[model samples]
Target: MDSDELSEKQNRGVAARIREELARRRVSRQYLADLAKISLSTLEKALSGHRPFTLATTIRLEEALAMRLRVSETLDNVAAISNGHADEQFGAYSRASVAWIEGLYLTVRPSFGDRQAIFAYCTEIHWNEAASNLRFNEKDRLDAAFTQQGTVSIPNLSGHIYLSTNTSGQQRLIIVSRPSITGEMYGILTTLQAGRGAQLTPVAAPIVLIPMKALADAPLGRINPDQPGFDAYAAYLKRTVEEPFAMFLPGVAAP
Candidate 1:
């Protein structure tokens, strides 16, 4: 069908869902109309299938009625199925099970050069595979496995350990060690500058990945993981439209 027809049908569906939710919650139609800043008559017509909707109007309805419309798949599928453009998926897609670490965080060490390190101060920890198992004299020790390869290209990783590439092609991994809040903003902001329409999101608790091109756009600064608001980077990730994936690791917990 035509775009207008599809949009009209979707609007009707949205209106119906909103009315159903309001009725289920015992909220009056007039109350909803007032909260939505729309006239009761307009609300009635939309709900009764007599009026079309604009994108802004639909968002308003959601805000006023507190109802979420299942439109992502509908829109995504329509574009792909109708236009033969299968690469138009929006939002985050999970490729592999994302792993999480509680106390560990990500920070970019640009000065560290093409090599990134995963440091831990623990008394003892075992390696995943052929990697070395070494005891550290201090609280901070870099995972020599990641450094062995020198600037490994990874889709996702945990605490100085790099994982396989993102077969899903929806994400790219970035490693950052001991970054400040402002430093993170700089990183993401720099990435945004390079990425433009691209977005950012955190797969693990502290590790954030963006389109590889965004790296040039990210700002520079030292980040401290021990301070408050360090996790704010995750919130920033959630604000964007990108695929987010995480895997469960041995010592890490999912947030």
Candidate 2:
């Protein structure tokens, strides 16, 4: 085919992949647009075949989805490199072995901004074929701009699951126990808390992950004390401490 025809075909392929991902993840187009830092109209036009996706827009979408849409000659080699590194780092667990953990969870934690409120969001865990490991992404967050996506590590020896994000040198971590009989995971989350005047403070808080399927028609986002499910959500977060899923140590003077 001619160059224009090849480009058009490629655009159609990328658009199809994007649509598939949106359906698979059950994410709204507006959410994807926000995550990709693109205007909704632009994404709509591109998806509708009225406008071709620019290289920059395609890259942004790929990063937002944490998956590749465009085919590259070196794609296999890149996947092999990622798989090799991830296998060693994430305990080499095969997709079948960790299949049970691949689903949506209602992630709950103490709100950083409100002492008496709980922040709720949706988290999706799925196997990354290219990376040969499990991956996770947080969505439906009130603070959507700060949403996180990262690799999941499940080490057999520790018997704990870790969701960690590393950008540049900064890192955010969540360590949770294995799923309970009811499919709830309790844990602690460690990340930088934004303070006044561009200041950031190191902070950690208890967190809980409940299977989305278990919470039928429950509200997400921020749950305050007066909210309907606040009490239950608070109880789940408290499990991270009461069950002793994680411990907090006070600082001691150097010896």
> Which candidate has the highest TM-score of all?
2
What TM-score against the true fold does each predicted structure earn?
Answer: 0.28, 0.73
Tens-digit lDDT track of model 2 for 1-255: 333322676687788878877776677899899878899999999899988888878878877776666755335443555543457678777677789999999999999999999999999998765445788988788997788887899988999999988654478999999999999999899999998999999989999999999999878888999998899998887778877888876678534
Per-residue C-alpha lDDT of model 1 across residues 90-185, encoded as one tens digit per residue? 112121212122122233322222122212111111111111111011112243222211112122232233322121122333333222333221
lDDT on C-alpha atoms for all candidate structures: 0.35, 0.83
Give residue 34's error in model 2 in angstroms: 7.5
The window of 10 residues in a row where model 1 has the poorest summed lDDT is 129-138
lDDT of 2 at 209: 91
Question: What is the model-wide C-alpha lDDT for candidate 2?
Answer: 0.83
